[model samples]
Target: MAVHKLLDDLYEHSYSLIAIHSPLKDYRLAYFLNHQLSLKLKRTKDDFSYIENTSFSTFHYNDDTTDTAWHLITNISKNVVNETRDTDLFGIKSTTVLHYLVPEYKKVDYFLKIDNGDFFYQLNAVLKIINEMTHVVTAYTVDPNQLKSKNNLIFLSNA
Candidate 1:
């Protein structure tokens, strides 16, 4: 009898995730990143929606010079729900629910994903420039492999 083993490394993650903490809105942060990193990131036509009624704003930029793709995605999505009950004076209650792309890092405002195998060497410099932005509270790298929702980062098809 011959034995065969399955290969688990078929889908290798060749990307780097950088968690950004900032108060700036998605577009504003993209603007700051564009100015600081010399990247021309623009909003995509369709927002990334992994679940019903929840969508995350996404910005994309492809650096032809370096043959790399960059994506700036909001980590949080807010949805409002209206509920009616006789106990309330107005009989209506409004609630806001939050959704996360990577639920493990709920406090992270945004994620910067770089799709290039060789970009890790320059990751530190990129983080430094992002951190220096006045509007950005702080920016640091996050290992995608360690994320429980790592598969959510696969947005190339939607992009």
Candidate 2:
């Protein structure tokens, strides 16, 4: 599957997932961190330990508990960019969720928006990255009804 090449092209370098919780929960950040790390690093559950294996740190929105917190995943802490949005979903917040394709990942023609953002912005982000890919492809899991194939964004049913 494409995930194999997506993983193979990125086999050597690191990758990160920026997962934001929809319902808003205390553990969403932590849970996604665990899942992303384990999946990206190919680490087994027994080996998942941020303190022991990685320098990546977790940050949460301050004083704005209502604004959903995003999981900023990246091989390099520098790849994660924070911004403020005036959008409907989370506005006037201190932190925003987005990632840049580091040099290592640019060659791979794909992007992923596993579970993130309001429909408009997330798809926009997906397109921005998708346009950068040559033969590579993008895939993400979301409710089928919410997917819009403007440029063929790969859809994954939650099952």
Candidate 3:
């Protein structure tokens, strides 16, 4: 399946915190994200006014300028450690399957830091979906407490 179509499906189901990867694609990881976001923007022309307005954004640490990409990616994982906002959905796309197995960053952080409440169930549902997809491509199950001690300093939390 096309990567964009996969993301579109997730978006439709109200899963804002998502991660996507495609082993079949040979292009840069950013290419798929930019393509999909632009398409969504075009399709949602009447309601969405900005790239962020589409309700999802792509976050990457490795723009290929430095060695901090992994650090940045981990920091993002740390900060969201249980994000509660339903409005914040993001995707991490990469052609390499190894990128998918970077030691439980996003999934673990989000799961561990979330506070118990109404959104917990919903978030669990989304994580399950994400895990299903991740496992298919990377063979690693998303574990909530997988990276409790892991730290990356580049993308430090503002809070």
Candidate 4:
């Protein structure tokens, strides 16, 4: 009799991550990307929600020609809560709490994820165009394997 073994590669990463720092809003950034990259990215019906009362805005575009999926998601999520406080003016106060999708790169405004991108994909060209945008401060490639919260990026299925 021969022993049989099974291998599970479900968690293997086959996508590219790009960190973008920009002052533009999510829609504005999507518009700029659409114009620059010739992609028609649109906001999906549902935002990417991981935890309670926290959700990140997401824009998606699928290129049927290349069979690649692009997702642009915000790194930060803001939630406002009302609480009772003993401070001078008012007993009740509202506070804003911030949540990060990828805590390791908190400074990054957004993340551009390219899924099913093959060898022919021009990553450098995309980076160059993003970097040249007037509203974008910088854009650079990031290794998903190096991130601790890399699992959070598995929202591709939701799209």
Task: Give the RMSD in angstroms, all C-alphas superposed, for model 2.
Answer: 18.5
lDDT of 2 by residue, 1-159 (tens): 355334322222112232222322223433543343332212122311233232323232211332222222222222234467877586545543333222234232222334323333444464444334332234333332332321121211110
Off by over 4 Å in 3: 1-119, 131-149, 153-159
lDDT of 2: 0.30
Task: Report the lDDT tens digits of candidate 1 across residue range 7-96.
Answer: 755677689899999999999999999999999999999999999999999999999889889999999999999999999889999999
Query: What's the count of clashing pairs in each model shown?
Result: 0, 1, 4, 0
Evaluate model 4: give its lDDT: 0.91
Estimate, for each residue in 1-159, the C-alpha lDDT of model 3 and write its tens digit: 655434322321111123343342222323433353221111111221122212221233222332221111211211122334555475433231111223345332211122222334555554444345422242222333333432221112221
- Rank candidates by lDDT, best first: 1, 4, 2, 3
- TM accuracy, model 1: 0.92
Instruction: In candidate 4, list every pair of residues with a backbone clash.
Output: none
Tell me each candidate's RMSD, in Å, in order.
1.9, 18.5, 20.8, 2.8
Which model is ahead, 1 or 3, in terms of TM-score? 1
Per-candidate TM equals 0.92, 0.21, 0.24, 0.90
Model 4: residue 124 alpha-carbon error in angstroms: 0.5
Q: Largest lDDT belongs to which candidate?
A: 1
> Candidate 4's residue-wise lDDT over 61-96, tens digit each?
988888889999999999999999887487898889
Score each candidate by Cα lDDT. Answer: 0.92, 0.30, 0.27, 0.91
User: What is the lDDT for 139 in model 4?
Assistant: 97
Supply candidate 2's per-residue lDDT for 56: 29
